[model samples]
Target chain A: MSHANLLSPPSSIPPKTALSLSQKAPLILAASPTSSLPWPLSLLFSRESPESWTIHENLFLSSLRTGDDKSARLTLDRMTTRFGADNERIIALRGIYEEALANTPAELEKVFQGYEKILREDPTNLSIRKRRVAILKSLGRPADAITALTVLLENSPTDVEAWAELSELYASQGLWAQAIYSLEEVLLVMPNAWSAHAQLATLYYLSTPSNITTLSLSLRYFCRSIELNDTYLRGYYGLKLVSQKLLPLLSDSTSLKRNNDEEEAGPPPKLATVKKLEELATSKLAEIVRQYNAGKTGWTGLDEAEVIAAKALLDHGGIER
Target chain B: MAQPIVQTIHRDPALFWWILLPITVVMVLTGILRHYAMILLQTAPKKQALPQIRQQRSLVRGINLRTHAKVLPPASFQARKAYMVSAYQEGKFLADPESRGKPRPNPMSDPAAMEGMMGMMKGNMAMMVPQTLIMGWINAFFSGFVIMKLPFPLTPQFKSMLQSGVGTRDLDVRWVSSLSWYFLTLFGLQPVYNFILGSNNSATQSTQQMAANPGAGLMGPEQDPDKLFLSESENLEVLEYKWVLEGIEDRLVIKFGL
Candidate 1:
């Protein structure tokens, strides 16, 4: 059982490591001549289980991500043989493969045209439509991408991934309000997404320049994000930043009065409460950095960039006004 | 005469090899064939126009909002609910604005609905035709002989059915004809199908029959999606929103000992 468990896909493998592993898969598969035997005989003679297909799929996607087009093509051929070329998932994979193979802008345009042709034949092929949007975005056409995404969302409003993508596209163009709205739409579909909440808070913070009301709203969302996922270092970091920004403003009565006059303003926290939350963020972040730097077990999951950022923030004695 | 003694007709041991084995093997093979036949016969889902897709998905979006409303704050949730309610009432997302307030087309007469019915009929036929052919084949080739005895007793009511071909008047009810053996294998080969074909195979008739009912499987092409969306919007309107993140800070404090 332990051996079987070990042979299963390693859930802890980082994406980068997984990509490299998948890139090597074709070589491994080629080395073993028996790996390509017809499925029925392989099932009877070898220890091949259903998990092999999943591994192949992962290999296909990773190969594409790493720009190993040859491995990706081989993986796609294997998948198409197994599942048939007409299979919906296989068709989507083929589209992704073509997208990966397109090197030049003209090639990308060809892929985009191919997607449009498929979409005309079957309007419900949302995957193909999404690829088309990605091609447009890559082609330096944000306006066209926005229009395509909007049309897609109008048809499939509950697609959280599309909503998140639309939010990013909006954010890239400095359309903060539209980005925030799209992110809220994503939250509507998946409410407990703490990462999304933190993302939304970041958008809110970026939209305004030291506005007390926006900062207070950002602080609440950050708190909500950390509340949902207690170990979200980014959420904690946002909370510390917002609380610090709000602390100075809360102490000044004129700024507090100005915040109260704003319509739709989130309720500002008390000065003592903000101070306590800031202290909590500081201590938690310090502990995380110390443990992670010590190479302690269970703390290695913290992103290195985030820890460095937190360390730098602590060293700076918080963001100077 | 007093009550007659129950007479047992002993069947040949070769009956197991010839009659029982052939029937069981044929039943299993036919089941495997039927599963593949159904797979081959399945039609790909047809695409809908943009407006139609929008109309259906808008309703689903409303339902999702209602169900997952706890994930959003009160203000955001209220804003969404208000927008959805008004949109639904206004028929803003209707696929064909001209069809608004008109009577729904009859599911039987509609060509798309006819296609849906045909698909169901095909599935049922795939399940039924082979079964009848195999049963007839068994009756023709392997009849008028007692094949096996049941391990358990059956009441006299089953005597007529289980001993269909064999006509010995006073034979024990447990002494069943080859037809009964065919019936047993027909019902009992489900586990074998599961072993060979994997679970969720179309070879299993009971599950397939249950799924063949109009409302059981994926939304068939026959049903009016507009009506579905309208009803879903009504459901959404009555939902009471409660924010799950309310007092989340306290829970976090308790969890992390902050």
Candidate 2:
């Protein structure tokens, strides 16, 4: 399952990868279209891998991403001919194509109305529903976008992608409880998503009253995140914060006794445990920062923004500061 | 006890070229035909409305909640369990709440159900038609002849099957008739097809037929979602929950040897 993801458009395409992928768009288009004829006729020609269509789809997206609109248009045309313009997913892709090429606010609005028209005709097309949400967000109507996204979620509650987007929207609006609930819904669907665990931990950390109860929740979640993926820089950075924050809280025996009085809430970790975890996070963060700064091969995939942020956290010293 | 007599039948060597060979070749070719026919018959999936999607996904969401409740914190888990139990009991997530607790409509009356049945029927037809034709052909043309002998020994139970057309009760179980050869090729020509048409080719009947039961009926028109929701609710209620994050710090410290 650890595929190279040549079939699907990568969620976040690095500049180097994006350029390399867009460069292949012409090559794919030049392959002169594999047989789309049904079975027996299809058998006469060079067999098409099921991956070919998805590859073309991804190539189309990457071509758009890298501003190769000519190639993107060609790929889009090829796909439209194969899948037809009326196909639901292709219609969404075409919408994205228009959105990317729009020069002014008016054109964007036109694209928005087009999405609305499609939705009015067929309200059940989930892809168009999502594009409408995107358009509304880009148009600076956060309220409308939220409503659109919620409607999308109501139609398909198991869509972890939509749930994550909902969480992102709520987090941006500073609605901590709703944001956390959306993320928890995401975790409910995909429990072992380490990034999601880390994201939820961050929401808890950023929420008001960084109390012992909340801090400890963040601490365990970050621990779980790193447990799932030790190399995760954000997990290490968040762990460094919570484990340090809990150090002083755990040191005070009176605070421990106070926490113990709340029988339903679990006991916080011992002071020594917190100290060890804090040291572990600090060392791991330092190592990651060092290796990443040295331009090491394995560490190169770490997001540049994240590596810098980790470096800043390390430089800022501890919570006592 | 006296040694059982071996009933050896002398047959012309030309029978190998004329009878056994042609049946196997035809069986293999027929398999290839069926494979292509199946591919041609495959229908594109039909899209569902948003409400139906919501209904199906709601059931799935509850199943996901039940499946991964252990990953959630105790409070979150309890809250979700309570809400899901209540929602399921109330049948709040049904695509059409009016259909709740109602008996499923007869499959023949539902067009979607009818389409599904038709696809299965087509698959059966694709399988059954050529087989009965070939079987009848072999019976009419080659039935009276004893065709081939097995190198290895077999039990007496195989006599009824392997010596089908020949009425002799006392023939050695290892000697097989032409019809039995056809039966043998029907079950065994997959590797030959794989060599010719590639491994995933639907030329093989036994293995391919088993795989052809398309999950077209996945939460199909038949099931009462209200019942599914209730059962899922009970499943969630009875789940033994353990939060993965509990004591995760100690596990991490030990893992990193800090």
Candidate 3:
């Protein structure tokens, strides 16, 4: 399948409709378990496709999510029977089930203890280790969670999910520099992730107290993000916001003078160039809002709240300029 | 002894349509059938319990760490290596903690090992049974007949095997019986099978042999990944670390001239 098709449902099928269909899947399967068994089970027996496993796994997760613990347990049992109880994925699922069952902090603590015991026996269980980190974070132990996640990252540097989680944890702790570093690690693993680029720009923007250098760095990162994904609403929004903040700094020579002794936060773009880029961002944001507001087919994917916010910015920038 | 002049025998054209073509078609069909049969016979992979999975994947994780260590900085790699080596030595990731330090059970006795062997046996059987049956069918019906002449020459040693049904001692080895035609189709129809059933079809004997061979080790359940991990840990411990990103900035400046 083409990557675009894989990412988005066919244009004929709306995303919300597809989501509702998936949501209704567990209900249908729960209603007719026997009929569901024949097709996937027969496919399993025929060995025509291994995709049946993924279908079953999704069914299990959905069942768990919908509070149909009985069906969830059944699907889990079926998966364990097919794959074996020791399969890595099944173990992860079992951990998730335990997490779902733990209503009280005490019960969560018990689950935490269970994970620790399992980790003691098998220190390399990265999934369980991740779960332990999550439990620690939930239990208000950010330090322990950070340490655990760092160790996990050391072993599996390519784990994008863990890196993203660690970044969030660091961000929550107001460790801006560490959060930026962790997000950079995420970028290193998945350099083309435009979302991460925008996120890192946001982080950089938030880190310093309205410094010209930091604003410029944030602007460049936002531009890089928009360069990777042209249609990214958040990237364009960030670009406009950062540039608006930057334009005044560029015009004022005194604000820039304070940071002259420090290392240049990259080669600072010239004042005229910064002004031009800010205008470009404003124009792009206006175009996005206009297109999205007109109910254009392709622009339907743009967030309504963002479009409204952009419109407000355009109106606000009109008076300021 | 005096050498005699070569004598050419007139062969019937009817043999091509009557025997060779029929046998070729049958062999191809059997191959397609065997491919589907093998697909039907294949069992889904048995799932391992969480601890077993942990034990297997933890070792895998260590091996991955060792292999991809260059991706990490020196400090991180050192920390991971130290942890993995110590954990491996202590049997921290053993599926059953009580079973550690005890000698491994004979693979023959292990149920999982037996299942692997059974899968191999099934593949071998799938390839062999149809072959033996076809050979017998050809031999019973089409014996004592010279069907066609090969376009190449063979030594006198082949005469006993290839020309088995034909009692004529003076016939060239190239002028073989229908049974030899069966053997030719058996070995030579691999490409035909590939075309008919796709490349990874289990119908081909050569592939089955490759799977059965311990050196190829492509098929069958793997030997315990825990043991594999332990050995990998030893390898990682001994490996000389050379940090690839040691002077990354300098290299970048040299490349990009920024």
Error of 3 at B215 (Å): 16
Give per-residue CA lDDT, model 3, range A57-146, as digits (tens).
Answer: 665665556566776677777778667887777888898888887889999999999888887876767889989998898889998999
TM-score of the second chain, cand. 1: 0.85
**lDDT tens per residue, model 1, A186-304:** 98888888999999999988888688877867877888888778778888888888888888888988876644335454456667766777887888889888998998888887767
Candidate 3: stretches off by over 4 Å: A1-22, A26-48, A66-70, A258-265, A315-321, B1-258
Ranking of predictions according to TM-score: 2, 1, 3
- Where does candidate 2 stray beyond 4 Å? A1-9, A36-41, A248-265, A293-300, A318-321, B1-14, B167-173, B194-220, B238-240
lDDT of each: 0.78, 0.83, 0.71
TM-score of the second chain, cand. 2: 0.85
Candidate 2, residues A43-113, lDDT tens digits: the string is 77854667888888888888888899999899889888778989988999999999999978889999999
lDDT of 1 at B229: 62
lDDT of 1 at A49: 55
Candidates 2 and 3, the one with greater DockQ? 2
The per-model DockQ list reads 0.44, 0.69, 0.08
Cα displacement (Å) at residue A34, model 1: 12
